[model samples]
Target: MGKLGKRTVAAREAFAGKENLTVEEAVSLIKASANAKFDETLEIAMNLGVDPRHADQMVRGVVGLPNGTGKDVRVAVFARGPKADEATAAGADVVGAEDLMEIVQGGKIDFDRCIATPDMMPVVGRLGKVLGPRNLMPNPKVGTVTMDVAEAVKAAKGGEVQFKVEKAGVIHAGIGKISFDDKKLVENVRAFVNAVSKARPSGSKGAYLKKISLSSTMGPGVSINVDNAVAE
Candidate 1:
């Protein structure tokens, strides 16, 4: 088993559907059901029945199992000078500031994520038109901006992931499947919940966290209570 153990029969049974779900009830249920279960990744399926735009508010993001994303990630590192060399050495498909525009212009800047060194920020900024819609813009907040090429490459290669939220506050991300371990799934769920909570906009007043739900991509969302989840 990579990390999380197999998905328990309990989790499957507990998160049947949203026919009858209250925030607190869902949280207690998930917490209790996942005690001994282990799954590399949590497979959560959501039926928010909302627009993708609104659904964006619900889903936090998706993640790979600890056994690894299980497949290779197409990584492109934006760096120049020494950092470029470091990125290549660390296994990144290095792209330089000089060739940045042409690369973006060629319209083949297809990659799961993009990491740029501090020096390349200007260049990446110039190509905002090309990258904005793709959502591949470089950001340090997510650990994309850097001079440490090796660490960047390692993050890109090993733990590469993406994020987003749905309208119903039902963010769906992946953890290892039931075959991994329950702890892994629990840990992944915890990490995901923390991230989403922190992403709350300052303008979001009152009960920001109205509800929380987790499930597989094709599964159902088990709820998490947030009546007290809002920060004072």
Candidate 2:
């Protein structure tokens, strides 16, 4: 076997026997072990008990991280006339109407978040096949579809993160960056957890939050104690 790289070896040793720690402890460990050359995104993955296959059990929502996500979020807006101008004035990276749809149809989706005014749904609806799978489809429930373009764009560019449960009953999102203060990271993690908790569908029966894990982009995951993670 090839010798383990120094960073990899160090990460492994740092994670050994570390599991089911409190949220604060887990975040501290992940932050310390994230010694990558570049600033790494601090990611959180939650194993929930709901099945997305069932319509009523689907878990999806958005949360604004208090400390703001350290990454620059690219936003694409689909609107016409005044709404288009509103989107642009709000710092939207890409704003357009049918032309934007044509670009997306050509498989050239270049933005991370997609937003659309209520009137533009008819146009955006046509691209559901393209955006739905990417989880970039705008939804009013998540504040991505709205008439308030300015606030939506600002929120998207700030630290708002959208999360949807996968087929495996898991939801994952980057809460902050490794460089964030431990207190800020902990606050962001708690905020995200609370949002998911509040979005719990009526169909959920057992323990809603099954597992919580925190990790940096290049580090090993550290399991966080579910109770501590979900506590307000």
Alpha carbon lDDT at 92, candidate 1: 77
What tens digits encode model 2's per-residue C-alpha lDDT throughout 190-227?
99999999999999998999998889998889898888
Q: Name the top TM-score candidate.
A: 2
- Which stretches in model 1 have alpha-carbon errors above 4 Å? 1-71, 160-172, 226-232
Q: What TM-score would every model get versus the actual structure? A: 0.63, 0.97
Location of the lowest summed lDDT over 10 successive residues in candidate 1: 223-232
Candidate-wise lDDT, in order: 0.57, 0.93
Write down the lDDT that model 2 would get: 0.93
